[model samples]
Target: MAVPKRKTSKASKRTRRTHQKASSNAVSYDSVLGVYKRSHYISPDGYYKGRKVID
Candidate 1:
């Protein structure tokens, strides 16, 4: 088993753990549907990039 030679500092541990948490998705307001949805993603109603993709 490999062992670490030096103990990790608080800043180092926190810096590594900074991205370990869940990130919130960005939202955008749809003028056509009049609802808030995830940015750059298709809505559940099947719309993408401000246009209907599927029914």
Candidate 2:
């Protein structure tokens, strides 16, 4: 089995993981309902793309 030749340094490890950090979800405002919701998803009031999709 292949193995690493040396222990990874803290700085090197952290640098490699810089792009792996958690990111916030995309949110947008629902003008009709006057609320915020995740982008591309239906709002709590059953609206999608600025139209009602469910009762």
Candidate 3:
């Protein structure tokens, strides 16, 4: 099967770059209910000092 070619726009490129830049700063995880959870205070030095959740 041949895939159709799509043209990339400058707006799309800028949006992609912005998203990449933002996501590069943190780590995210998913809870048991399948909802997305993200951390804002995590350091780029690879250490996770966030709080834990207790049942």
Question: What's each prediction's TM-score?
Answer: 0.60, 0.83, 0.26
For each candidate, C-alpha RMSD in Å?
Answer: 2.6, 1.2, 11.6
Pairs in clash, predicted candidate 1: none
Compose the digit string of candidate 1's lDDT tens values, residues 1-55: 9999999999999999998998899999998789998899888889887799988
Question: How many Å off is the CA of 8 in candidate 1?
Answer: 3.9
Model 3, residue 1: distance off in Å is 10
lDDT ranking of the models: 1, 2, 3
Report the error of model 3 at residue 49, Å: 17
lDDT (C-alpha) at residue 19 in model 3: 54
Q: What's the alpha carbon RMSD for model 3?
A: 11.6
TM-score leader: 2
lDDT of 3 by residue, 1-55 (tens): 9774997788988988885654344447634334334564434333344433432
Runs with alpha carbons beyond 4 Å of true place in candidate 1:
6-12
**Candidate 2 — which pairs collide?**
none
